[model samples]
Target: MRVLSRFKASTIRRWLLAVGAAAVDPAGVLVCAVLLWLGTAGLCIAMLLVSREDAYHQAIQVGRNLTLVLERDIVRSVELYDLSLRAVAEGAANPSVMSLPKELRNQVLFERPTTARYLGPITVYGPDGTVQACSIETSIRRTHRPDVRWFITQAEKTDAGLYVSAPYASRTAGGKIVLALGRQITSPDGKFAGVVVGRLSIDYFRELLDGLSVGKQGGMAVIETNGILLTRLPYNRNDVGKDFSHSPVFVRFMKDGAGSFVGTATIDGVRRLYVYRHIHGLPFVVGVAPALSEVYAGWRWRASWVALLMALFTVALAAGAWSLMSELRRRQVARAQLQRMARRDALTGLENRGTFDEVSRREFLRAKRNGTPLSLLFIDIDNFKAYNDHYGHQAGDYVIKRVASRIASRVFRPGDHVARYGGEEFVVVLPETDAGSAVLIAEEIRLAIYELDIKHVKSQYGRVTISIGAASSGEPDTVDEAALIKAADMATYDAKSTGRNRVCWHTASNGLNADEHIKNTEPGDQAHP
Candidate 1:
C-alpha cells in the first residue's frame, strides 16, 4: 500500500516554515500553504491509483480460479464421451461381438457408459453410413442425414482420434442440442469397416454450469477454439453455437492457449472481464465472464470511503494552516509595536538620533539623485546650562520639553523629520528646501521659542530663548551627512557668540557663499543685547 505517500515529511517542514515566515514576508505564508496542499493532493492521487490497480488484478485472479473449476468438469465430460465412443467402435469391428444376440451385444458395448442421463445411446454405423445397432430403441438423431460431418470425418481419417462434432439440434422429442462424438473402426487390412458415435446432451453443459455460484451478471461458457460457443450459463438458448470469430478477444483465445481480457459482448454489448482456460485434451475453451461492473464493485466502495477521508483530512489541514498563520500574524503585530517603541526618544517622544542619522543619509542620496536642496536645522537652548543652575533641574527639563514642542510646531512637511540630536539640542531635516527657505523656517522657530518668556536670570537675555543654525547643500555628493551637520553646528556657535536669542545660516555662494552669514537679529531683540 502506498498510503504513506499521502502526507510527506518534506511538506510538514514547509508548513513550519510558513508559520515562521509570516512576520518577515507575509505573502510567503499563503504561497507555502498552497504548495503544501498541492503536494498532499498529488501523493493521495498516486496512492489511490496504485490501490485501484491492485483491486483489478485481484479480480482477474479470482475469475481465473472460477475458470479452473469449470474447465475441469467440462473436460471430464468430453473425455467420458470419447471413451464410450471408443468402446462401441472396438466392439463393432470384432466379428465375434457383432454376432451376439441383441441383448448381450448391447450389454457388452453400452451397459453403464450409455445409461447415464447426460449421455444418449451409443450406436454403430456401417461403412454405408446407416445405423446398424443402438443401445436404446431410438437411433442416432439423423438430423444431418446422408451428409453428417462426424461420419464423413471418421470414414476419411483412419486415425482412432475421436471426432467431437459441433453442436447440432437432435430430432428426438424436444429437439434438444447434442454433440456427436465419433470413432472409426478399421479392418485387419486397415480399411474402415464402420464407426461408433455417442450423443452427449448439450443440456448437461448448461445444467452443470448453472450449479456454480457466479453472480447474476456473471457467467461460464464452453467455446470452441474456432469461436463457436458450445453453451453459456446464465443460460441463453439463443446464444448457443454463436460464432465469435470477429471479436478481438476471441481472436486471442484462438491464438493463445489460455489468458484473460476485458471485452463487450456483441449481441448484448455487456462488457465483462473474461478469464479462460484451454482444456488440455479437447478443442474447447472454458471461460468465466463476469461483468466489469461486478468485478469493480467492491473496489469502488472502498475507494469512495478513502477519497472522502482524504478530502476531509486535507480540509482540516488547510484550516489548521490558516489558523496557525493567524496566530503568527498576531505575534508579528506585537513585535512591530515594540520595534517602534525602541526607535523613539523617551524624553521628547520624537525619533531618536539613530533614526535621524539613517534617515538623513538616505535623504542626502535622494537629493543627489534628484538634484534638489536638502537642509538641516541644529537648535540649542542658548542659556540652558545657566538656566539649569539658576532655576532647579526640574525646571530645566520643563524648559527643554517646551522648546522641543515649539520647534516641532514650526516645522511641518510630509517628508521633513525631527529628532532629539542630543542633550538640550534637537535637529530637523527638510527635503526640497533651499538655504533661503530653510533660514526663514529656522527664524520662525527661534522667535517661537524666545516668545515663551521662561525665566533665565543668569543668562545674557535673562530669559529662556533658542539659537537655530541653518545649513543647506544643493551638491549633496560633495557635502555628505557629516558635512551638513558640521556646518549647522558652526552656524549655531556663530549665533550664540554674537548674542543669544537669534537664528543664523551658513552656506556657500550658489548654496550661500561660505563667507556670507544671515541672522535672525530683528530690531526689537537687539535692545536686550
Candidate 2:
C-alpha cells in the first residue's frame, strides 16, 4: 500500500513538473501584449476625438465673441451716423438754424459728429435729388446729384427711419467705396422735402478690423441681410457690394439671429469654422470665419505628442515582451536539456537505472491490472573485461555505447524502455510482451551485437558479442517488477556461464527454482562445463 501511494505521488509530481516546464510560453506573452496594445490604441483614439470636439467648441466660442464685439462697434458707429443725420435734418428744417452764419450753421449741422474720426460731415440733398447744403463745402454747391443711388434710395423710401445703403463708389470721397446712412427730411406739412446723409468711409471699417486676427487664411466680414456685402478684412475691393444671397453662409448658418458652423468654403474649397451675428436691430450680419485647420491646431499638436508617446509605449512594451519571451524560451530549452541529462545515462545516452526502475514498476502494475504479460531483457557484453585488458578501457566503453544504441534501435515500441543497468550490463523493459516474443526479441539483440564483430584478442571467439537473458510474467497477477528484473538477471548469468553469444529465456515466478524458470530452451541450452 505504501509503495503504491509513493508511486502515485511520484507520478503526480512528474506530471506537475511537466506542467511547470510548459508554463513559460512566448505566444502567451505576445497575445497579452496585443491585447494591451488594442486597449491603449482605443483609449488614444477616444482621447483624440474628445480633444477635437473640445477644440471646435473653443473655436466657436472665440469666433462668437469676436462677432459680438464687432457687432457692438458697428451698432455704435451707425448710431453716431443716425445722430448726425438727425442733427442735419433738424438744422435744415429749422429757419433759425439756417439763418445762422456759415461756420456756426455748419457747426450745428455736422461739426459735433465730425469731431469723431471716420464720421464725415453730413450732406443735405434737396427733394429734387440735388445738393442743397454741405457742411464740408463753404457754400451749397448746387450739385444736381439726381443720379446718385443713395439719393434715389432715400427719395423712394417713405419711412422716416434711418436707411443704410449698399456699398457704392463715392465720387466725393475720391471714388472710394463707402457705406451711406440716410434719413428723409420732412417739411412742416410732413412731406418729404430733402434727405440728410452721412458717408462712413471704408477707412472706418478698415481701422475697426485692422488689429483683429482671425487666422492666416481666415477673414471677418459684414454683409447686408438683403445680400450686399459691405466689407471684409483681408479686404478685396471687388468683393464689396457683391451679391451673396445664394451663399451657403447666408442661407445656412445665418439663421436664428446668431449661429456658428464648420464646413467647406464655396470660394476656395478650404474648410472653415463660421460664427455669425445678425446684428439684432440692423440689416447686416457680422461674421468671423476661422480656418478649420487653425481652429484645431492646438489639438493636433497635443494629439501628435500623445500619439507619439503611445506609439513609443507600445513599442517598448513589444520589445519587453519579445525579450521576456525569448528568455523564457531559452530557459525552457535549458531546463529540457537538464531534464534529459538527469534521466539519461552519461556514457550510453540511454535511460539510466533510476528511470528504468520507476518505469518498470509502473508497467508491472499496469500489466497486472490489465491481465497482460510483461517482459524484461538483461543484456551483458560478453568478454568485456578481456576486451578492456587486451585493447583499452576506451574500447570497452565504446562497445558499451554501441550495444546500448543497438538495444535502443531494436526496442522501438513506445511502451518499451531501454536502460543502462550497470557497468557492462543493460536492461530492456518490454510491456505487454509474452515469453515467446521476449525470447525472439532477445535473440535479435544478441545477433545484432554479434554482427558488430569488434576485436577481442583475449577471448576465444576473437569478436565482440552479448548474452541476453529475457524473462516474462506469464502469470502477471502473481508477478511484480522485482521478480521480473531478478529472473532476467538470473537468465543472463546462466547464458554467460554456459556460452557467450546466446539468448536465454525464463518464465518468471516468485520463489521458483532457477532451473524451472528457464522454460524457452532452444538448441544449446546446456551448462558450459
Candidate 3:
C-alpha cells in the first residue's frame, strides 16, 4: 500500500511540473487559446477582403474589354453606312446617272439588295427638306415632304463630315424606329446642292447586341453626347430616346469621358459593373454592363474552400500545442533556419535582393525616425562578361564569389548591409554615413578588389577591377530607396564610362562631374610607385 501511494505522489508531481512549465498561470493558457481563435478569425476576414478586391478589379477589366468591343463594332457599322451614303451622293452628281432611267438610276444609286438589310429606302432631300428621289418607284411630288433634324443639320452644317440624327419613327419603313445618317452634297464648284440620307434600322443594332455573351441581366447601351439614350439591349421601345442625364453612370461618363463603375440599374434594379467609352470621332458613348454576381461567382467558391481549410488548420494547431509542446521548440528552430536560408544567396552566402529590400526599408524607417543620414553603393565588376567568355563560366563564378566576400568584409558596421543585387553586381547600404565618408568607403572597396590581382586579359588593367557608385541621402525623411538606387546606378554607369577601376559619387548639381571621382592618392596618403 505504501509503494502504491508513493507511485501516485510521483505521478502527481510530474503532472504539476508539466503544467507549470507550459504556463505559470492558468490564465496564460486561456489567453493563448483566445489569441489563437482571434488570429484564425482575422485571417479568414483578411482573405475575404482580398478576394472581394480581386473580384472587383477583374470585373473592371471585363467591363473595359467589353466596352472596347462594342465601340469597335458600332464604329465599323457606322463606317459601312457612311460608305453607301458617299456612293449615292457621288452617283447623284454624275450627269450619266441623272440621265439614266428611274429604275436603273435607283439601282445605281442605292444597291437595293445590300442596303435593304440595314437601311430604309435611300432618299435624296432638297435644301427645302423635300424628297427629290427615292430608291422605291414613287413620285416625289406625291410623297409627303418631312422636315427632320438630319436634313436641317446637313443644310446648315455643310462641313460636318457625317450627321447622325436621333431615333424617330420611320414613315417609309411602316413606323419602325430608325435613325438617319446624312452626308452633304456639294457641286464641283463647292456650292451646297442638297443632302443624301440613309435611314439605319435600329433592329440591326439590337440584333448585334443580342449576339454578345453578356449574361441575362447584362446590357449594352448607346448614349448621345448630350446624355440621351439612343438605343439599348433587351429593346424596350418606350425607353428609347429617354433622357439618361440623371443616371450616376452617365454623370461620371460626362465628367471623365471614359471610365468604369458599379451601380444598380435604374430600369431593372440589377447591380452591375458598367464600362463606358466615348466613340472616337463620334458624338456617342458606348457602355457595356455585366452582372457583378456572375463576375465573382468563381471567387465566392474559392473563398468557401479557403474558410474550410483555415478552420481545419486552427483545430490542428490546437491539437499540436497540447500534444507536442517539446517538439514545438525544435520546429521553431527549424523554421528559423529555413527562413535564413531563404534570404541568403546560395553561392556567395550574402543577403539576396529580397533580404536587401526588406533590410533597407527597415533601416530607412529607423533613420527617418532618428534623423540620421544613409548612403548606398552600387558595385559592378569591370569586363566580367568578357572574362566569363574567355576563362569559362566556372572562373567567372569564382570571381563573383571572391568579389562578394571582399565587399562583405569591408562593410563591417552592425548597421551596414551588403547584398547580391544580381549576377556580378553588389549593393551595400551604410547608415549614418555622409557623402564624403561614403566616397571614402567606395575607394577602399575599389582598392581592395585591385589588390586581389585576379587576371583578366581582356581588361585594360590586365587584372580584374571594380567600379563603384555611391549616393548619400542627407535627409532620410525626404528620400526613398528607389531614388537612392537610381542615383547610385547612374553614377556607376558614369564610372564605367569615364574609366574603369574608379569610384564615383553622385552629385545633383553637376551631374556626376569629374570632381566626384576619387583619385588613387588622397591628402596625407603616399602615392604608389
Candidate 4:
C-alpha cells in the first residue's frame, strides 16, 4: 500500500511538468507570431508605396520619350519643307518654267522626279496666296483654299520660316486629312518670293508610334486639340476614322498641356492603367496604356518576399536593440564631439577666421550706422621667417600661438576680435574706437609681442616684434568694408616701410580734398605725408 502511494505521487509530478512545458512553448510561439504579423504588414505597405512610385516614374520617362520623338520629327519635317520650298522658288524664277500663264503655270511646271527620291508633292504660291505652280496634276487654276491660308498667313508675318500649321480641314485637290508646312522665300536682295508649301500626310506619324513599345500589353494614341483621334495603335480600322472627343483623356489633355496624369480606361473590355502626356509644342497629345494585370504582375509575389524578410529583420532588430544599446549611446557621444569640433580652430583655440570676420563685420556696420568711430589694425610679425629658420617650423608655430594669446588678452571689449589672418599676420577690429585709441591698442600689442622676448638666433633683429597699422573711419554712409580694410592695410605698409616694430596711423585729411586723390584716400583717414 505504501509503494502504491509513492507511485501515484510520481505520476502526478510528471503530469504537472508536461503541462508546464506545453504552456511555455505555446506562449513563446504566440509572441513570435505577433512580431511576424506586424513586420509583414509594414513590409506590404512599404512595397505598395514603392511600386506606385516606380509606376509613376516609368510613366513620366515614357512620356518624355514620346515628346522627344515628336519634336525630332517636327524638326525634320521643317527642314525637308525648307529644302522643297527652295527648289520650288528656284523653278518659279527659271525662264523655262515661267512662260505659261499663272493659271497653267502649275501644269507646265509638272515634271517627274528626276532625282528619284522626292517623297511628297511640292507647290509654289504667289504673294497673294494663289497657287502659282505645282509639280502634280492638281488644278492650280482652281482657288487652292488650303494653300491660300498658309501662304497669306506666313507671308503677312515678317518672321515666318518653316512652320507647321494646326491640323485643319484640307481643300486641296487631294482632300485627305493633312497639315501644311510652308517656308517664306526672299531673294538675295531681300525681295519676297512666294511661299512653297508641302502637305505631310499624318499617316507617317502613325507608323512611328507603331514601331515603339511602351510596356507589355501597352498601346499608344495621338489626339488633336479638338479631341480628334488622328492615330491609334494595333492599326484599328474603326479607330482610324473615329474621334474620341467624348473621352476623359482628351478632355484633360486639352486642359493641361504638360505633366504626367494617370487614370483607368477600358481596352478590349479590360480595365487598364493609362498614362497621358500633352505635347506643348505640337498640335497633338500622345497617351499610352498598359493593362493593370501586366503592370502589377510580379508586385504581389515580390511584396510577399519583402514581407518575410522584414519579419526576420524585425526579430533580429529587436534582439540587436537590446544587446547593442551601448553602441547607440556611443554614437550619441561621437555626434556631440563632432559638433564641437565644427566650431573650433584645431590649431589655435581662438575663434576661427570665419567666425572672427563675421562678428567684426557686424560690429563695424553697427558702429558706422550710429556715427561712432570704428578702427581696424592689421599686424604682421617682423622677420618671422628668420625665427622659423633659427628654430624649426614647430617652434615658430608656438611663437605665433603665444603672440596671439598676448594680443587676445589685451582686448577689453567682447566686440573686439583678434584673428590670425594668415601665416605670421593677424588682424584686430576695434568697434567704437578712433584712430588715436586704435594707435594706443596697436602700441600695446606691439609692446606685448616685444615682451615675449622669443630668441631668434638666426635673426638680424635680437627679439621678434610686430609692426601694426591703425585706421579709423567715421563716415558711415561714404565708407564700405573693403575701403576700411584697404586703409588699414596701407597704414600697415607705411609702418613696415618706415620701420618695423612700430605703430602707424593713417589720417584721412587731403591737403586739398581733391576728387582724384579723394578717391585714393579712405574715409576719416588721410594719406600719411
Candidate 5:
C-alpha cells in the first residue's frame, strides 16, 4: 500500500509540473496572469453586487409580507366596527326607541354586547347634529353633539352605508387621538335621521405594530387615502393626523396604488426599504420599512473575504511570472555567447573559415540573382615559412593576429566579409565591386600591412608584407564559387612566383598572363583588363 501511494504521488507531481511548463510562456505569462486576476476581481465584484441586490429584494419581500398582514388586520377590525355602527343606526331609527325611557333607550341603542378592547361607546346624533343618546352617562348630559369629522362625512355620504374618518382628537375620550366608523341613519319616509358613530382608540394599532418583528431601526405606519397619518409604531403623539401628502413614499404609493420602494422616512428621516399595501376595502394604506444597513450586514463580511483571497492570488501569480521571465532572459544570453564562440576565430576575433564560406556563398547567390559584381581577395603572408622558422611559432601567431586585424580594419563596409582562411592566409569578400576597384582596395591593404614595419631579416622587403590576388565576377550566375576561388588562387601563385609583397588580379583581357598586365601598370595603379 505504501509503495502504491508513493508512486501515485510522484505521478501527480510530474503531471502538475508538465502542465505548468506547457501553460506558462515566459514572454506572455505576466500579461496572462494580470488578465486572469482582473477577471477574477471582476467576478467577485459582480457577485458582491448580486448579493447586495438579492439582500435588498429579500428585505423588501419581508416588509411586503408584514405590510399585507397589517393591512388585513386593520381592515378586518374596521369592518367589524362598521357592523356595530350599522346595528346601532338601525335600532335608533325604530319608533319604539321614542317611547322608551332615556336610560333604556341609550341601553338599547348605544350599549351592546361586544368583545373589542379599544372600542368606545356608540353615540346617536339627531339630524340637526344634537346628541340623542350615548352609552356613557357623562356624555348623555352634554348638550352639544360630538362635532367630529365622521359626523360631517356621514351626513354628506347618504349613499355610503358606512364611512371611516381620518384620525382625530376624541372629545368624549379626553382628547386622545382616535379613529371613527359611522353609519347614516334615515327615517321611514327616507329622510336623513342621524348618524351613529363608533370611535376606536389609536392605541389599538400602535400596540399591534409594537408586537411586530421590525428590526432595531425599522418602523410601520397607517395612512388615510387623503395622505393623513393615522397611526405609527414608536408612536409620537404629534405624528398622528399629520399631513404626508408631499412625502416621496406617499406620492409614489398614491401613484402606483401599491408597490415597494427605498426612501427616507418622512416621520424619522431614516433611510429604509419600504413596502406598502392598499387595504382591499378601506380608504387606508399600510407600510412596513426596515433600515438598509441591517439588510446588507452579512454580505459585507463575505465580500471582505473574497477581496482578500483575490488579492493574495494576484500577488502570487505576479511573483511567479517575474521569476520565470528572469530565468528565460538569462538562458537566452548564455545561448547567444555559445553561438558567438562557435562561429568566431579565437586568436583574431574574426570569422573562421566555416562561417566565411557560408557567408560568401550566400552573398554570391544574392549578387548573382541581382546581376551585381562580386570580388574575392586571397592574401598570403610574404615569406611566412621563413619568418616562422626565424621568429618561432609564438611570434608567427602574433604576426598572424596583427595581419588579420589590419585586413579587417581596411575592409570595413556593409556586405564586406573578412576571415582567417587558413595557415598564413586571410580572405576578404567585397560585393558590388569590379576588378579595378578590387585591385585598388587590394593595393591599399598591401600598403597598410607593409607600413606595419615588422622586422623580417630573411624577407626581400625587410618588413612583414602581404601578397594579394583579387578576382571579380561581373556575371556571377555563369561563374561558380569554386571557379572564382580557383582564379584567385592562381593569381596569388603568380604574385608569389614573380615577387612577394605585391597585389595581382585575374583579368579576362589578360588571357591568363597576369604578369604581362602587371608589367605595364604601376604598383599603386588600378588593374585593367
Candidate 6:
C-alpha cells in the first residue's frame, strides 16, 4: 500500500509538469502574433506597391506607343501639305505639276492684260526691305516688311530654301489662322527673286486627332516643348490651343528628354489612368489616357482573389506564431539587415551606385528648382591598375575605401553626396556650390590623397595621385545630374590627358557654347612628360 501511494504521488508530479508546459502565456503569444502580423502585412504592402508601379510603367509604354503612331500620322499629313506647296512652286517655274489654288487660278486666267498673273502670291522684297512685288492681297498694304518679326528673323537666319512657320494667327487677315511656308526664290544670277509663300490648312491637326480611335472616355493630348498643351479631349476642349501652366506632368515632361507618366485624373464623372509621353522627334507631348479600372479590368478578379487568400493566410500564420516572440524579433532583425545591405556599399559604407543615382537625381531637381548652383566631381586614382598589379588586390581595395571615406568626410553638407561609382572611380555631388568652390574642394581632395603616400611603383613619379574633373552650373534650365556628370567626366579626361594628380575645370557656359577646354592646374602637379 505504501509503494502504491509513492507511485501515485510521482504520477501527480508528471501531470503538473505537463500542464505547466501546455499553459503558454497569453501576453507573449499576443506580442508574437502582432509582430508576425505586422511583418506579413508589410510584405504584402510592398508587393502591392511594386505591382502598382509595374502596371503604371506598362500603361505608360502603351501610351507612348499610341502617341508615336499618332505623331507619325500628323507628320505625314503636314508633309503632304508641304509637298503640295512645293509642287505649286515647281509648276510656276516649269509649268508641269498641278494647278494653283482657286484664288491664284482666277487671277492668272481672268485678270489684267498687262501683268502675266504672277504665281501663288509671290512677295519679292529686296535687301533694303523694299517690296519689289507685293502679290499677296493680304500683305500688299503693309509699308515696311522689315518691321515684321518673322520676315526679319527668317532672312537674317537663313540664306536659302523653304522655311515653314509654326501655326500663328494672321493679324492682317482679321486674326484668321494660317500655316505659312516660305521659300526664298533666287534669281538666275544668284540674286534674290522673292519668297514663295504657301498657305496650309490649320484645322487639319485638330481634325486628325479627333478622328483617332482612342478608347471610350480616353483623350488624345498634345503638348509643346514649352509646357503648352496644343490639344486634348474632355479635360480641355478649350485647351485646344491653351497651355497647361500649372500641370506637374508638364513640368517633369519638359525636364525628361523622352519618357512617360501615369497619374490620377477624373473624366466624365469617372476616375482614370492618365498615360502620357513626350514625343522626342516633335516639339509636342502626345498622350493616350484610358480609364485605370478599364485597363486593369481583366486582372481585377485575380488580384482580388490573391489579396483575399493572402489575408487569410496571414491571419492563420499570426495565430500560430502567438507564442514565438523571440523568433519574430530575430526575423525582423534579419530583414532590416538585408535591406541595409541592398542599399549600401560594402566597402565604404556609402550609398551604392544605384541608390546614389536616385538620390543625385532628386538633389539635382531640388537645386534646379531653387536656382542654386550644383557641382559634380568625377575622381579616379591615377595608376590605380598599376597599383593593383604591384600591390595585392586587398591593398587596392583599401585605397578605394580610404578615398571614398575622405570624400564623404570633406564634402559633408546637407544635400551633398559621395559614392563609389565603380571600381577605381568615385563621384561627389555638391549642392549650392559653384564651379570655383567645387574646383577648390576637388583640389583639397586631390592633395589629401597624394598625402596618403601610397607607393605607385609603376607610375612615372613613383607615387600615388588622383585625377579630378570639376563642373558646375547655376542656370536652372541647364543644370541636371547628367549634365553635371558629363561636365565632370570631361574635366577628368582633361586632367588625365594633361597630367595626373590635378584638378581640371570645364569652362563651358550654361548654354554649352564656349569652347574653353579643360584647364588642369593644381598644387604639386606638373604637366605630363
Worst 10 residues of 5 by lDDT: 518-527
Report the Cα lDDT for candidate 5.
0.80
Q: Write the per-residue lDDT of candidate 2 for residues 1-529, one digit (tens) a residue.
A: 9999999999999998866655457776777778889998999999899999999999889999999899899898888678878878977877677678877877677765544677666788888977767877843344787777878888888788888888887767767788888899887878888899888877777778777999898888888888788778778777878998898877864567888887676656778898988987778888899998898889989999998899899889989999999998898798898888888999999998889999999998998899888888999988888788878888888989998898888887898899998999999989889877887788777767767777777766678878888777774433678988887888888777766677776643433346544543333342120
Per-model clash counts, in order, read 4, 0, 0, 5, 0, 1
Candidate ranking under TM-score, highest first, comes to 2, 5, 1, 3, 4, 6
What is candidate 1's CA lDDT for residue 60?
79
Residue-level lDDT of model 6, residues 322-355, one tens digit each, is 4364565676677777776777788888778887
Q: Which of 1 and 3 is the better model by lDDT?
A: 3
RMSD of 6: 41.6
- Model 6, which residues run further than 4 Å from truth? 1-43, 89-153, 159-162, 169-178, 211-220, 226-229, 235-237, 243-251, 261-529
lDDT of each: 0.78, 0.80, 0.78, 0.66, 0.80, 0.65
Q: Please give the RMSD to the true structure for each candidate, in Å.
A: 8.7, 5.9, 34.4, 35.8, 8.1, 41.6
**Candidate 1 lDDT, tens digit per residue, 250-338?**
77667677788888866567888888888887788888888888777877787798789878977887787788778777877878867
Note the residue pairs that clash in candidate 5: none
Least well predicted 10-residue stretch by lDDT in candidate 3: 520-529
| Cα distance off (Å), candidate 2, residue 471 | 2.7
What are the per-residue Cα lDDT tens digits for candidate 3 across 343-377? Answer: 98888989999998998788778777897888889
Question: Candidate 3's error at 385, in angstroms?
Answer: 99
Model 5 per-residue lDDT tens digits across residues 303-409: 88888888788778788778877886676677776777677788888888888888888887988899888899999999999999999999999999999989988
Q: Each model's TM-score?
A: 0.72, 0.83, 0.52, 0.42, 0.77, 0.38
* CA displacement after TM-score superposition, residue 465 of candidate 4 (Å): 99
